[model samples]
Target: MFCFLRKLHKMESTWPHSLQFLLFFSLLFSMAFSKSVIEPCNSSTSCNSLLSYLLPSDMKLAEISTKFNINPIELVGSNNLDQQTSQTLILSAKTTIKIPIQCPCINGIRQSVSTLYTVQPIDTIESICTGFGNLVSPDQIKAANDLDNSSSSLESGQSLKIPLPCTCFNNTDNGVTALYLSYVVREGDSLDSIAGAYGTTVTDLVGVNKLGSPSIDPGDILAIPISACSSANMNLYNDSLLVPNGGYALTAGNCIFCSCGPRNLSLHCVPSALSASCPNLQCKGNNLFIGDVEEELMGTGCNVTTCLYRGYVNHKVLSSLSNTYRAQCTSNHSNPLSPSLPPSSIGIPSVHVLPSLAPAAAAPFAGHGFGSGPTAVQIASSATVSTRTSNSAPFILVFLLALMLVFIPFDPNVYS
Candidate 1:
């Protein structure tokens, strides 16, 4: 009886140990299965058989959806804390995220936002568009922007507007359909040269032409899209562009360190100072600012008023610029930068500095003769004289008729 009781006690002890072993194996199996299904999430909450992970830099919603065997919208919406809400999210390398056990929202899903990007070196249109979350297809990008689907190369510094996948699913169909315009290739035209000229990508031209070679012959007409022109074809020195100071560097269609020029000054197109096509110093656009200064000189005691007017003419030309140079120049006041001259000798053109040697009535047009043209007041006077002559001529005629009737005989009898 004692031996049998001892055996039973040993068996009971082994049973407790056996139970612990089973529990340990069960937990291990569960962890292994979970690892296969979901990525490891850092949050402490026990996984309800689901997993989550930090997004890789190259990961996109479309790609992630395919990999996880779930809907792209569903996966992105739930996993994205910052993206789910409209609030800004800072996603640095070490940011932690919680992967929910169940999908959060039923009806709504994350959408994509369109983006604009500039082309960089060694970039292909196909690679660039696809690399950025497959937001824009090569065919769609080509079609929307009027690029040739044949080539897929891009030039450095050319900007492209890309559609991005974000929570906001802007029905991209509502966006403007871009058109591609064609330009005849001129002499010395390369694919890159043409792209630069039209502000398009070489890949676009290659896609359009289906050209295997980079060498482009003159007279090869290329199709370019309006977006390319609008975003990429920025010219800082275009005659139409305003130049503020003597020099300006244009980047992304905006000017830096520049000022506005006179309105009427004719802009001369020139090669870009920074770019290959940027205008030289002799180009009309280059002189836009200097021409403005020259015009303002007329108002500020300089005798030049015929300069062109742009947006900033009135401010620079009409108002006297505060003299930067306090010391006077020459006894005759010819040179602008002479030192030894007196404060009284410091002269501006015809402004307050120069007293009129001529009479007050003829003060403005004094040296200027009649053939040169009438002064502003003279022109006004001529207009008044013409109006009075028109009004008094009729009265004079009637008065002359009355005098004739008084002096001469009446002719009524002859008519009868």
Candidate 2:
């Protein structure tokens, strides 16, 4: 002890004063932040089975679960510990316990390799599962960790296995035949919007999600059904199947609108009549012409919205009047569009005749007749307007040239 003390005193004397202070703080920091060593298993078998753990001082199952993201109840169940044992505020130091390894899922399938996690000070099963996009459920963690009760909390410095949600299918199940996607709900999201975005309906979403009610809370994970009941034709709108009972066709002047039927089984469409009073009618149905363009209809017995054709207007007349128009259709199925022939085309030029300026104006004689020509004053005014236009042409050209010079980049080196 005298020799050690003498060596320390010699080293302190040799070291700079600042270096001694830095060394003391560094040692203190290391001691303060030091952690216990928790070894992982070597193979899948060992990972699935119980591994040895050394309990740190004053740590409980609750702290272990939070720190490691393990279900505390599972920890107790794995060791066959009594429920009363978990209530103890502190566990003895150096207590040996067995920890189960949790296997994570990849693309909805479990991986062969198990992952080991150390319990953190603030870890919880819900938080951990949420980190994985809610792919892991609390029940899954409990079962994997062998937790007997859901109320058990975790202790810091405890080890846990995180079992991921994955399953192997034998290709015989109904779910294997169809493709599914997982969607996490966000704030202000309703079943209507979610279903509409995915080309599905609330009924279909409820059935797929196994939801007892239409209400869904934020952060709820949903499984979306994306598989087509029957192969959809690429030529159709939205790559959807056209059912004969509920199918839609483009008519020469009819405005077509389609919706994805329940469960995405078929595409249903309804047509509305054209009108001139409507705004922006010209832009609508520009690609379509006067003839029924039909595709092979598939699937049947689907509920479709029945639409009525109010009347048809001449395409040329409608285009000249407005750039767009809203095709009005009522959802009342009882007032369906008449399957009768559409009205005759009303050309713009043939609609009306302009009135003469004079009162009691007589109709102009179709046959040739002598009429007065332009007067001197009118001719002189025309000449003056023509001269002004001719004179302004050069100035307009010069102004355009100046604008070009301003906008176009000029390279002096290129001229050189």
The numbered model that scores best in TM-score is 2
The 0-to-1 C-alpha lDDT of every candidate, in the order given, reads 0.30, 0.37
User: Tens digit of lDDT per residue, candidate 1, span 1-416?
Assistant: 23432443445444453453354345333322210000112232221111222333433445444433444333332332212231223333222221212212112322121235667797777566434423334554564456765566677998675522121111010121122333333345566654554334565445433444555433233333222011112232322332211112122121111211112112322111222221212214323221222222322354322122222221221112222332322233333221222222322111111111111211111011122332222222211100001112344446544543443334444346
Query: Which RMSD does model 2 reach against the true structure?
Result: 36.6
Q: What is the TM-score of each candidate against the true structure?
A: 0.18, 0.25
Worst 10 residues of 1 by lDDT: 382-391
lDDT string for model 2 (196-267, tens) is 644445765565444657876554545443322222432332322222111122322334323232333344
- Once superposed on the true structure, which residue ranges of model 2 sit more than 4 Å away at CA? 1-118, 137-139, 148-177, 228-416
How does candidate 1 score on lDDT?
0.30
TM-score of 1: 0.18
